[model samples]
Target: MKKWLIFSILIMFGIFNLNEPVLAEAGAADLTSEAAVLMDTQSGAILFGKNEEVKMYPASLTKIATAIYAIEKGNLDDQVIVSKKVFDIDGTRVYLNPGEQVTLKKLIQGMLINSGNDAAMAIAIHLDGTMEKYSQHVNEFLESEIGVKATHFVNPHGLFDEDHYTTAKDLGIILNYAMKNEDFREIFGTKQMKWDGESWDTTLLSHHRMLKGEIPYPGVTGGKTGFVDQSKQTLATTAENGPLKLTAILLKSEYKKKIYDDTIKLFDYGFSNFKSSQVKKGEVFTSGKRQFTYSADTFLTDPIDEGNRTVDSNGVLNIENREGKVIQTVELKPIIKKKLEVKNTAQKAEQSGVLSLNSIVGGILLLFAVGVLVLNRKQKRNRRYRSR
Candidate 1:
């Protein structure tokens, strides 16, 4: 009876809430897809994963590279003359006829939204002067900036190539890079994009159908869909749900609808089971020993719009190590009427200020000279008065 009483009291204080880690059995539902990953879109932490690092053909998903390349290089207004070879590429297409005219920007939208293989070829050719050079940029970016070794691309479109490959883990890395780029994120998140009244007089009216649903998930923003007989079906989706905005990628899914369903399940699992840490408003993180104080909820003229990230702070980042010790996040802000650059300066003025040693020494010498002259004149006057 006494042991039970003590256990109950400890639980109330949260000293030992359960005295053990809660091992959730990630149900077999997660294993249905050959590869899957759920990640925190902000901090890029993996919440759940299966066969994440396993190598596989990424199919149309390869266009992730193509889309990013187009965003970086091509201007929407730049007219691309349909090359004879681009119109003839053997895959999906916007059905460009040779001698046709289209903007590189619209071609990209078609490439991503319609998964048009020929559009992909057209955009690739337009951006780098040839498909070959654009593909080199993709390879270098994957290995260098994205830090992905398992991912390699042969085409701007994710058409099946004997050499092209990626994994669920590599997709996470790519998304991490993509999320940081405003243009890339915007393209990925767009539900519908319509551009009309240009010289070519065309609009890319993208209807990513699932994004229109109002019932279960109003937060499903936007993402990409990939499929081919060889790659089966692949979907990568993202959403903003309260404090957590997250993403889930599914490869070799059955149909486009299954991509939505599977992605929804993965997101549901992440939101229902896992919760992230919050740094509160007006919270002060202080370490007197280190002479540091980090304050949150600082005032701006307008309330800050947390676009890519969100926070809930009772007031501060209670940063902790593995041992659960508080490592302070130094809160820093400007003081009134002071140059912001001066914040790095020391308080000791003469000891540490901008004036040099010779300047200070010269001032001291001038003061000493004046004092000696005054004393010498007073002594001379007193002797002359006594003699008179």
Candidate 2:
């Protein structure tokens, strides 16, 4: 009986372990890029990372920053005169002549869609007055506005400047911030555009294979590709599946196709294993004595098995997976409920009433004592007068 009972207990333990959903061994495999990152654009969660913070050359991916900066700072309707220095820029060109005049908007399209170094130069010169000034301005903008620390730029056209470097993680940060601008989003996702420049009149096509549909990727919204001897092959791609928006960054890949392959793997991992989980606006969560409600729908990319999220008194929500790894942090706006305020006031009033009653009783007792003493003194004085 003892042997049979022990065997049954062992069998029950095995069944219990099998019933539990075991978390797959963490991290992705077989990515070829030297550095890669997959990020949820909505929640800014790094789903997968491999040397993402290590600095690498950005190459023409620098144009991603230049395009948005020009759109924000320079007037699109303003005509930019192509300087002679623009013609001297190395790599692909829109064949701009020294005195050619092009609108700032058209130049942005050429630079982004056709990867035109000439157009990039004209835009930079027009915006910041000189390449040196443009480089400084863009670097500051990247740090201050986009919150990217691991990035630096020396030129608007991503020529191989030794100082020009960025990390895959930083690129994802910049791209996510840039996508918020309506004008930038339109230009970034554009697959092709017509060029009416003085030297080149052909249609400009985006060099990014995924964006151009040369390489089909599901739900591909936008992409940018970069290459140089120093940077090797770098690619940034953004895609949306259902409510989840994802950005994938790959840098310093040895082979060109390897970048695309890495991006696909990142996307698959993000979309398949994770989902956009939302805590609706006004959903209440308690932290310590304070209760906080979601100011807006807190949309987060979470693992499918993410059990419950907790909000702290600091108004930060922690989304944790089943394995208890915190995957996302959301800063929520703290709400003040009128009922709670009223309750606090009522409690204060009750305490105030107790204090007031104590004061009244003490004042009454002191007044009665003083009256009794005065009366006694009057009686004593009357007795003395009558006796005399």
Task: Name the candidate that leads on lDDT.
Answer: 2
230-301 in candidate 1: lDDT tens per residue?
788787777877766777888876666666677777777667644555445544334332222234542211
Model 1 weakest lDDT span, ten residues long: 301-310
lDDT of 2 by residue, 1-388 (tens): 9998987898777843544443323434587788888888877887778888998888888898998888878898998888888867889888999988888988888888888888999999989888889989999998988799889999987788779888888988888888888888888899988777676678888889989888789899988888888888889899999899999989888988878887887887778778886679888777777777777776677787555578865779887766676778877777676555788899999999999999999999999999999999999999999999
Off by over 4 Å in 1: 1-25, 193-209, 214-216, 255-257, 275-388
Model 2 scores worst on lDDT over the 10 consecutive residues at 18-27
Q: What overall lDDT goes with each candidate model?
A: 0.66, 0.84
Score candidate 2 by TM-score against the native.
Answer: 0.78
Score candidate 1 by lDDT.
0.66
Best by TM-score: 2
